[model samples]
Target chain A: MSENIKNWLLFILTVAVVILLSYLANSIINRKAESQFAYTPQIEIGAHEPRNVVWGKNFPRQYESFMRTRDTSFATYLNGSKLRDALGEDPRLVVLWAGYGFSKDYNQPRGHAYAIEDIHNTLRTGGPTGPGTGPMPSTCWTCKSPDVPRTMAEKGIGEFYKGKWADKGSEVVNPIGCADCHNPETMSLQISRPALVEAYENMGKDIKDATHQEMRSLVCAQCHVEYYFDKNIAGQEGVPYLTFPWKYGTTVEDMEKYYDQMEFADWTHPLSKAPMLKAQHPGYELFTTGVHSQRGVSCADCHMPYQSEGGQKFTDHHIRSPLDNVANSCQVCHREESGALINDVFQRQKKIKQTQLSLEELLIRAHIEAQKAWQLGATEAQMKSILMDIRHAQWRWDYSVASHGGTFHSPVEASRIVSTATEIAQEARVKLARLLGQLGFSGEVAYPDISTKAKAQAFIGLDMDKLNDEKETFLKDLVPVWKKEAAEREAQMPIRPVSSRE
Target chain B: MRFSSLKKKLLPPPQWRRPVIILLGIGAGLAIYIAHIANVGSYLTDDPTACVNCHVMTPQFITWRHSSHREVATCNDCHVPQDNFIKKYFFKAKDGLYHSTIFTLRKEPQAIVMHEAGQEAVQSNCIRCHISQVTDPRTAAGVSNHAENRLDRTCWSCHRNVPHGRERSLSSVGFHLEPLPVATRKGSFVPAWLDAQVNHTSN
Candidate 1:
């Protein structure tokens, strides 16, 4: 009714409206921040904190989920976290790797959680009491643990590599975790391995300048790429320094050229007497050629999709074969039916296996022929070209096979590598025949009887009894010591819990 | 004359004015509330149901039902979120909203891109649950080492087939036969007799 009353009411109404709007906006902003910063540091995470539980106090979801890599139930068509004895299914491998430790025991890879256990259980790393006593170098544990980076930092990189695997067993206990790839302060992906950084450096590139999209796959490349130990680095002598043979390039041909230039050989073939190169798993390199990668799909895109629970969301920490979860891994990118996507993977694998097996048979024959030539007193000059051919052929074969999941990861490239291997092997056999004929021997070189794994071992002249006996002795005698030492060391590490009220 | 003129000049307000104002207020409130609810709902159901929403995933769902991890895990259990709650939630909210919106619109991603981050997430969850009970010392160690080095190495490095075994058919697990045992239209189980008959006839 009065002018003053009307003005007072309007002022109050305006204030109420402004207050409500501000509260709503603030709520929205707070929720966004909470989702990103829910994990407050309960206790200060040391730079070298190897244990994930320590990190768990601050980030429970990640730590709890990261711990799940131990599940062995999910299996895919081509890849999963379960261990399968590959040599048992195909005994031809024993003959192929006759002089190598792999022929003794080789199982399909499992989840990252089993990295430490698998290495310890393998007979390849012989039992030893101290440094330099075991068959395997300390570099063997490099890819298995985050403790590796911590150890490398404490002891200079070269010094860490200058010993046997058994010497560091007590120190490297934790499995792969966050510290391996993420910057603790920013939670952004970071390269922790020096080898990857150094490899980039050799190419005149800076890792810090890598694009964000590249970091997704680059993180996996930290461990999954092909690598070898270079004991001849100028100042790194006497140390089996881990290195990627990427000086020439990242392609199969590039790596082959680099290895050839260095005259690098993993081991001399027992039967063929050829200098050989072993291709470590090159999952990243092969994946780069896949349709998905071509489409700019990072490994993190399909394998680590987002998840929600209890009004909160988080990244699922489980990593295994993509076939295990096609809907999440492939369906996100491919419109094809689940069956169709799986069929695509299987088809690629089947086709690749066809060529791979053919190459294997050819390689077996080549090795036998080379041995026969050497037995006939062939000179190094006479066997030179044949040996080189054998080396190149096996390298190609190993490149395709050792790049685990390469068929599904990059079917076209895998097929090409296998075809190349078949051609090289065939050429080697032709050369071997000529050399044998010149030595006054003729006709086909009789293939060895390697129908069974046991028969193959006998053919290789491996004292199975002695080897097995030694493996058993090492496990029984040395494994317990490593465990005890590890327990004591872990006990010494400080673990401060967060104050609940805080 | 004056009282009669005043009464005639006074007119009642139109009946629709007050009702119209009330109706407009209610309609505006309903529109705003609906928009808010829709935004929140989109994030929850987006990709969460994408795997099962499609008919193609039906058979796989059946297999997943019989899977050992069925009780404790879901599709997301093995596929998304490699590590960290903050990162996980950010991803889920962002991707969930995107997927939910796209899936709701009946659009799915073409050419699935395998994410190492997603695989690492699934692998981490697997080791967390199963590592302690692992009987094999070597396997246990590998599991431990992998967990510690989660950023560098994946769990699939050693435990290659823990989830689904190899790609081979169940028959490849030693159940060899000419064909999978099937039920006839008469609801009778196909026996070894039928299997042999089919094989012999084909040969």
Candidate 2:
């Protein structure tokens, strides 16, 4: 070959090789990008698709891992996915929450998988055959199911919360799942509960503008946080509107101030005649004050870390206590030994428990003292301030204790809340003693004999037999119909297996 | 002049230099690859004997030794899954590559987060062996499976607080002191030394 021809041929050959290598690299990169975003609609996911198995066909990894919430073996010091009967374990709770539905039956929360089953089994829902008749309002099912969003979408949000708990039993069959916190089209974490969005609007904040990192914990916050059904909300009256008291703030004092200003009380205390307030679980709120949260650690960071399977990674949706997986949870943030980290949790828990027990005793005594004052013909005017103190005090106490995992989860904040409650309760008792003296009785009123759970239940006048009978009747008559209807409806839905191209 | 002559001889002509350099480079790469495959690098799995490795798992190892689950299980038994042959193998390979890379780069995170999926994998294995076995319907077990009543709660549902049953009971063989005391240097070795002394004295 001529020298010039040889040079030109070599140049052409080099350019061809370069082009081939670049094309190969680009193809590999594109395939990888495709793998991450390779979602194809294998089965039609309806708007009301509540069954996770159906969703699993389209998103196998998330679905398979979400099913793991059914595993109940994992236990921690204070919280886990396992079923624990709080009343059976500590019956003092029954008396403390006398004249309330929770006193009838209360259990430590299990995984989200059992939300529907646990609610069905609970005695609080009571027996009802007709609309607007059950013991619990339709708002009770708001946090328990993905069916909630579907119903809220079908019926207007206000209309959905307008009926009784049993009115929509069949309609709300699916437990909390992917739909509750995820948008099917995007698979992005989205708030499905209207209550959360409305609460944000009330505070002049837009939840849509939340950061991606915030969404990790915000998904669980949809259900786990405290809320109350406001019956007197203007223009929304009689709707039993689910509202968060975050207008003022989320702190115990802030919520108490808001309730006090509105002269709101959950119920007149059966024993003390004090205006009482019930504190729902404030897990997310208390969690935010912890060192972990301050360091930008989210609920999902510890509770739902990422897992790898078949060379692909996805978020694990088995949300529960982190202690069960310390290596994955705390060890990721703190280099402490697993045993040492567990001990850290236990130590905080034990110290807080000591004060919490003390606060409970003091509050119990305060209730009895207030009752004695009322018994002595103390005027309502005279008891008003004491009642308010009792109200605020017990609210604080309940806020700390009822916020499951609060002590170990946020020990410092939990301790402060309990201490403040103890102070207010002690002040209430002091006023009660003076009121009793003015009524011509001075010595300490003999405390009720509530050493055991049975004694406490009797003390509180809870007809357990009658309650259990009603529950049995409801389960026998109503639950079966709900389940049958749900099964019939689900069976009619479409489910298609993956097509074989081979 | 001698040095210049030596440099010229070592350098070789331009054409010869390229071939020589390429051949030497390929030979060096093959030798290193063989060495790596043969595990000839000073890679230390046990850092106690090889201080240069500085194993990052001492705390975990100690905690595992003291754990109640330690006797019945190992670290891998609870943390790794036994399902999906492909996935299991992938996990081992990925973890191996990751550890190797991190060791090479010296940039591993101080604390590793074990994913919820990993814990679930462990949990499945736990439930597999510990399935409920009480066949009799009459007994009032912690979790009874009464066919007549249709009340069949799982074993862990009620017995959730019983994992450290032996430690709580304290009557078992391996009951250590509560709120474990810091081991003194003398205290730790006293048992070993006493055993040796007793053997020597007896001999």
Candidate 3:
């Protein structure tokens, strides 16, 4: 117990403890590594196997997790796995999409597992009386099933898109699944849809050059982005070739330019009589302009965060809204509390929706005003500029709102798009007012009573009862036959078993 | 100010260089000795023992010990590439360097995670081992499985909870570099909203 001797003894004890702890750490990590490497090939998996059950036999952990996408319990403010009646919630949509099939019925997208079922149930596809009776083209099934790629491979891509929607009902049975975003050979993320590859090629960027992190979002871009069918691409004539109008860029203005160059219109607006552009869900396109994407955050970062079960880690396959799993999705990068993050999303969506609804109302009024101008013997020359204004304004509006999660994905961009749309719509209304005055109708044009979906449908001249009756017949008669045929075909495909070591 | 001037004046002479050199050499030698004892380089191999060199890997080790694959394979069997020696060891070296650096800096997360590369390796390994059971006969007849032709399917995307059971509860046990702040630790997930936003009709 000299003071110097005691200090030396303390230093020695500290060193000894550090060495012991290091040894203990090594022991623990070694043991864990042993457990993780243990594998017994329980089942043999084949190349390009579409059936999930076969893959599940060997990778039961991953398969079981993937199967959880079937659960529809989770929901967020704007979008989730829940099957929401989007058209029912906002009757203005019925008027906005007056001539489009979406006006009949549109539902919020649900989990990947329900892709096939939801498409079948939706009225947009219509009730078919026979193989080619459905209103939709075969191109409609592009994003809904893995069977699409399978069928395209068996029959050529052009041939696949040649028939009607129900023509290949028996062929396309499996819902969006494993084969849609991963390669069976390497199990690496790959873009399955040709449209996405071709879109990238148009932008002079090869998808093959995409980094691993970029592939995460690109795989989702395969189905989530806005697309259209073009029957004019050389050698693919008369086949509704799936194409993304992203040659210029992903911005609303950029896509508008692309469409304008082609003199393309999805349909002439029923009331406005303008060449209208229909904006499909442009999730990936708008998302690319968002803060998250700009900061290099991939869709999978939020929607498919890694989850641990029994010490094994894998990406959560239940892809849905980031808001549904704020802790793993947003909070992993954002330190804000769950309530705060959810509130942030809601606040953005609420504000965007306010402007969205106002723009919708204005467009509705503009369309009606144009119709009134026509009735009053307004010349085509007088109405041409007004119609173009209506088209551009509504296109901007639809572009912002149709992105589904654009508000949360990129609040500033969504706000700017809506603002531009609102200004254009007001200008169109003002022009409409002047035209009405010139035509000798000085008084205000009365707005149609479209307070409800049914009222809106009626105002737009849609016979909902007739549409529903036909849909019912299709579902009851043709649907069962399609399902039965699909089941029988799948049943005929045998699953080979693996021999277990004794 | 006087204390600082006095300290400067009391500093070692410019000619006394041998002691300084010896001290610096000893310091560098000790650092190397410590790193060696830690087995930092061992992680760059197809050895399960290398993974358990870190204390944080205890939960994974315990689970795998009791897993169905315990008797048949080891960690490198699924988590690393088997294509060629160079590629496999290269990945192992990259991963090992990253893990060592993070742990040394005390920057490891509470739970371990597998990145995209690790996921691909595990997925490919799954298909590689169980090739016979999952392949469809139609593929040989020129009807390719959509996954085979494109990058769209992985065995784990569906059979996630197999090999091991529930992971969240299992991973939450045993490993920690330091006690986590109670506020940030995993708790019963409470919703920010009582009903989903999808259920609401915006005004």
Candidate 4:
């Protein structure tokens, strides 16, 4: 064949093959789109169904993935899915929260699946003999279960809050699950917690106006953000109303101002005599000020990344630290190797932890100094300023470190909060030193040897032996009964089975 | 008119471009020849070995070789549609194009996840292949009930590790990719122009 004819033939063949492939590809894409949209749903989920098993019948993929949260094998440097005793790791926390329930016991939070079980096991709740006897209010159960929303719907919201933690044991059976965040009808993320909506209203912002991306984080904020039980809200008299102190804002100073305005003190510091504030897990609040949040990354973006199974893409509902799934979580956006990304998180945590320890040591000294001043017969007038300083300083420290992932979430902001707290602690100690000098005791008040949790608890007058025995009894006796009652109650609830289509 | 004149001026003479065109044609032919030698055309067949051409697919290929379905099916049996000739080839062609694009770009993620389209095809194939077992009265009642009420339960949704057991480490099979010398991989490796812009903002 002539060169011209040969070239023309070759070009024609190439073009023809390309066109054939293109047509094939286009048809396949169309078929795929059609098939995806035409799926016949297998089960109908009821509105506000708290039982995950019912929802799982419809979304077997999502539900099966969600059940993986029960696997407590993963662990990282600072945080992971494993159940860890936080107090056992850091005895300084006992001194830091001397008068609070947290000082009795605190565990590093595990996965969402363990939320209910962890709450039951924590010694902070104490061994309540019966209803209305526990130190914790019914509001304490607000974050632990999807059943909280169900109970609130069945009973009046006001009536739900008008009880003690022990009273709601059998009622809040199911751990945090689908109904806590998702609307059953559409499976869209929704804030079921009224406290979050009320907090939004307090800030003159309607949560309804929040974008879809914002809802990803807000659903987490339902339980993860800092909140307190307000027993004094108008018309909710004597009921422990769950409230987020975010009206001023979510920043440490913003929340301090809000708390100061309300004159709210969680409890008096036993050592310092300061009207102290205890920080709940401020994960959402701290995360909002983070670089990821600033760049529009939601809590779910890391904690609940999308996973592909078989051929379906759905949210992985096992809510745990991003550190555990660095490849899926951080490495999706970051180009770093898995080890490198993990190292980055660990380094940030390490740096923050160094400062956190220093702040804790300083606060311990301030509390001891304040105790010395009181012992030396310093007037209430003389100690008032010191007490306020201690309260503010400890509040800042607690706010910085209490938010589980705050250090890595916003290292710069976490550092700033800790530094300010350190300064306040030093200032408190300095004033306490002057008071001690004035009262004719000029020598240094030696730091207590609280190098262990047992030692620290002893220093703080916590009878650990009695507490542990009581907890053992409670777990052995009461927990089984509660489980039986809950199982029986759930068994009574009818599961509306879908009629078969011929 | 001015733009067309500029374009003409920028173009080389037809006779002068003949050698360059010939060289380009030779390069294209060589690439096609290499691809054919690699058995790229065999991907259109039911042979599962065709899926193992790239180094990235080594783990998957090895796992699938030992999988329970190895005797009964190939990769296409689950992954590609088998509804009809046109639909089957169409699905294969679309996936082939996507796989080639991602491979050529060197943008394969560490963990390979099936796309939504691939998932649907797999789900459909599962139902088609195991129709009797799936539609057994006891099993069908639960699954069909779910399908009637909410969304059809894709078989692989519960059996995630069926075809591949669980994805073993790529390193275990002596599979690794040489690191790409991309600027985005590290800030220090960025081009002078980008580095200048970055530093300029800082200054």
Runs in model 1 lying further than 4 Å from the true structure: A1-41, A498-502, B1-203
**lDDT tens readout by residue for model 1, B80-197:** 5646667666766765556545544445443233365566667677766766644456664667664456446666667544343323221112101111111101111111221222
Cα lDDT tens digits, model 3, A364-391, are 9999899999999999899998998889
Ranking by DockQ: 3, 4, 1, 2
**Candidate achieving the largest TM-score:** 3
Q: Compared with the true structure, what per-residue lDDT tens digits does model 4 show for residues A1-502?
A: 8979987997798777666555544544453343332332455566557888887877677787788889888888876777888888999899989988999998877777888888888888888776777677888888888898778777766777887888988898898898887666545566677777778768876666776667778878888889988877777778888888988889999999988888899999988899999988898888888899999888888888866555334467777778778877998789988888888989999999999998899999999988988888988899999998999999999988889889989899999999999999999889988889999988989999998889989999999888888888888888788889999998987676444433
Q: After superposing candidate 4, which stretches have Cα over 4 Å from the reference?
A: A1-38, A500-502, B1-203
The most accurate candidate by lDDT is 4
Give lDDT tens digits, candidate 1, residues A74-192.
76655577787777767788888888887777787888888888887776776575655878988988888888777876776777788888788788888888777655544556666
Error of 1 at B63 (Å): 31
Q: Give the alpha-carbon lDDT of every model.
A: 0.70, 0.69, 0.75, 0.76
Tens-digit lDDT track of model 2 for A255-334: 88878787777778888888888999988889988888887777888888754454233466777677877876788668
Q: How well does each candidate superpose onto the true structure, as a TM-score?
A: 0.66, 0.66, 0.68, 0.67
* Chain A TM-score, each candidate: 0.90, 0.90, 0.90, 0.91
Top candidate on DockQ is 3
Model 3 Cα displacement at A355 (Å)?
A: 0.8
Better of 3 and 4 by TM-score: 3
